[model samples]
Target: MINEFIKNIKILQQLKDNNVYKKYIEYIRYPYFRNLAPDSKITFDFPVTFLVGKNGSGKSSTLQSLYGCPKGYSLGDYWFTTELDPIKEFDKNRNCFIYGHKNNGSVNEVIKQRIHRDKNPDYWETAKPIKRYGMSNSQRFSPIEKDVVYLDFRTELSAFDKFFHFLKFYSNTHKSKQDFLRFYTNKLKEAFDTNKIISYYTPNRNKPKVILTKAETKIVSEILRKEFESIEIIEHNLFKDWGTSIRLKQKNINYSEAFAGSGETAIVILVHKIFSASNESLILLDEPETSLHSGAQKRLMSFLIKECIKKKHQVVISTHSPFLIENMPNESIKVFSTLNTTGKFVIDNDRNYREAFHELEIENTNKKIILVEDKTAQILIDKTIEKLGKATQDIFVTKYLPGGADDINQRLTTIMEITDDTYVVFDGDQKKLQKPVDLNLMPPNQQDTSKKLKELIKSQTGCDVKFYLNGGDQSKELKEKESLKLAKKYLEFYKRNVFYLPLSIPEDIIWDKKFAKKLLKLMKPEKDFSLIKKTSSNSKELLFNFCIECYGDSDQYESTVLQFVSNWINKEDSNFRIVKDLINKLKN
Candidate 1:
């Protein structure tokens, strides 16, 4: 079934020239994290999109790159972001637009903000200047709004797009208060409406057994739930029939340009729904996967592209799960680096990222890559030094677990037989680890980095690491004892008000169960529970299981028999294999 769907639909890159936003005043030239990945640059051009890449690569910054947001926007997608789905939103506060959490954050903040999501999406209902807890009198859709029609998905959507068209068509003939009669009359005439794209999802009736039977067709029902979240429909381009009931019309350049005769009612809903959401508005959205299948993501991306053909609405969102991108053209997608005002850079458009990074094609001289705990530290070294004009062609930064030098070493031994200029950052935990460097297969980034540490300590704390081996000072402690003391100091820096995950941890699990445990360990168990980013060990397991089921695990690794199993950890696609396989595996 999936193979048929995949075969029928081909994903193309829907490239658009997205003008990334940034404040004029706060531009930084050499930003601290300037070369940070996707969190840096951000852009907007489509109504729905899917962003993909490794964590810390600036994926979320693409959504939150609008003005009025608290801090300048960065790139990224956390757990359940729809920002990648190309739906944008601003905060109801009319504050700067914002999307998803920090770059180094969990994936599902929108889910965390459930009530927040419901509040403003319904704001369009009160056309006559309805104010929330905090609002000035100036905000409203338009003067004397005509009508309002809450399209309930239950019965309304099953008839599909033309269903509403028939309503308007019938109303033109029989100008009477007989909506139910009009519906039956339309059905009698075989004037049933339909959706060209998401038609497979069209339900027949409200009764469970009518379209999808829970008892008999449980699997199919589950598939419907996964794809058509809740199919609500509208007939026209406008909202309202009378007194602004719910009008629908097609634009010359509609969301679905190919379907010229009449745009899908779904596209009209998108425009009106967005317009209806807020005033001087900011919209925050998770993945716009709801009510849309992968095929629809492509159509929506094209149709929504022209929304900017008229209005310029600022949107912020997050998405780690990308169903939309799977359908997009290759050249269309852009990669971002950071969210801060000045540090943003686009991957595709920027002559630099593609030319410098991809084109020259740095040598895999050290093709034997070193997976750092937070490869960011190594990435910073490589990229920053590259900025300083160094050929880092040989260095490739991957991941090891945070606070996990031992794990890194263990995994390293399995992968590469020979190690070269490899690096590891260890906490040097006394009880947990041995010395200045805990079970390191490779030393830290460089010997110079270690030497720099010596100078840093000498200048600040008046202690010399050179004193231990070179016999310079009698007062200094031994390397192991001094490392423990220094480790305590480092841990203190790490466990400050907000904990920073140490390097040597898995990139995905950077904010995973272990991170939650760290938060609990740092603070009280109950109170810190909320403070922890969503992924704790249990959440990690659950998310992984879910991923396995939705998309198969084969994409997990290139050359592993356990590719499917390895794919469990990756949140690359919505059709996540891990969750699907795990369930089937369990059943079998």
Candidate 2:
């Protein structure tokens, strides 16, 4: 399943880069919207994009904006000015957004604004382009013509749940309505059990039936990890007014959503809606992870991707689930953050899984912690650990701190104090900090204290503390000794846990002449190898440009390039041995 997911993602990336998804909304820019900065732009480079952030960070708002991008859809449908939450539109802050889509081999922009009129109320309509420098007075285009489906899973409820939980039923005056509900409920159950369709009329003067479908049954079963013989969508007033319930048949037993898990019902509805949508439709999902466990969330994501690719649909999901974003390209994930200065939401484009995890404060449950300098180092260390086999991989979780070597070194003591099982790996360039120090030159009195401290460190941490002394005056010496006394435990802990990569930096390892040639051959065999040497003197920039050139500046470029570097390092090279020894030390 994982391999299939990877393959599908690659296919999606290729399609995106090739511009095969013609109906995709290219990008959306907020000139003025609710709590969003002026001119905040988010590009849609992948068929499926995940909008991730803390609650109220505008993730759902972003989805609503997207929902309004297609023709015949309006953000007003979801968010409109009410007495409690009124949106006052003025000349300066009119609450509008602009989006771009490809038309006739050229990109065209459309502006949608909320217009408050006497009769229309809070209606969203296409407005003339806002004047800007260098803007062309071209003919205006309507919103991209496409089918749009917006599902807010957080608010999705089965008809049975809605009626029984919210509607009036306990009053004696409503006894007849309650009795009718019970009669229809029993009849629906019997129909489900007997594999028959049943119809019922409602006060709305409409008749609806419970119809079974094999395709929906298979998809819902695969996602929810259940074996369903059949699935039915039941629409009847007994369940709720103008709503639907799901019925699942397993083995010889049949159950409505009233008896099934919420996740099962949600998945059935989601699958039905997605499969029923037209090709090249726009699908927006808000918190699809609601009512779903991690495994089900993963399967749901897989199903979504498959459907998107098969139907040429564009999907944008607002979620906080790591499972939904797992295996997705970094370019496909847009993280939202609120600005401290203005308290407005902003979209961050250059982010990956590590940043998302950090921003979301997702806890790592692994037994061991591996801290590194940056994202590249985190990737390298994580991939190397994977090469050490599943046991080693499962035990360790790698995290990269923001600042470079200096910040990590500054926080080493605090980190060690927090977790004894923590290990730190620095880029090979930081090996300069590992210089040896001689404590023999200390005076007899200081030497006596040092000896006691060393033994204390050894006894407590099971590691040797080697003092790296520098030549200085007595005042400096006294200060150094006192500092050592205060931080002796972590210093020894660091000596035991700290290790460095064999290469100076990830760029050097990746752009090594031989390694670069191999990567070029694998990624673009037709390109001349000398082009690498002729590129920028800065290896990092050169590698970045190389990846962009080969991969067409897509979101997967970094991961695609680093994946080769990690794979090469995982081989039986001298660097691999160093990584192996580092892991062995952590294991012991």
Could you tell me the lDDT of residue 402 within candidate 1? 62
What TM-score fits each model?
Answer: 0.24, 0.61
Q: Against the hidden true structure, what lDDT does model 2 obtain?
A: 0.73
lDDT (Cα, tens digit) per residue for candidate 1, span 1-588: 344333332321111222321111111111112234322333333322334433455444333332212222222222223555533334442212112221222211110111224534311112222234222344332212111112222122213233444445434644553554454433322311332211212433221111112221222112222222122232222112211112211222111111211222233334445545433233444444343333444444433333322233333333332434443334334443334584444444322212222211211233323334443334322332233232343333433456444444333321221223233333212123222322133354532243444444333222332221111111224334443444333322322211112232223322344433453355444343433234435433433433333344535222221222233234333222322332223222
Model 1, TM vs. native: 0.24
Candidate number with greatest TM-score? 2
Q: In angstroms, give how far residue 241 of model 1 lies from its true place.
A: 36
Error of 1 at 316 (Å): 12
How many clashing pairs per prediction, in order? 101, 1
Candidate 1 at residue 412, lDDT? 31
By summed lDDT, which 10 consecutive residues of candidate 2 come out lowest?
466-475
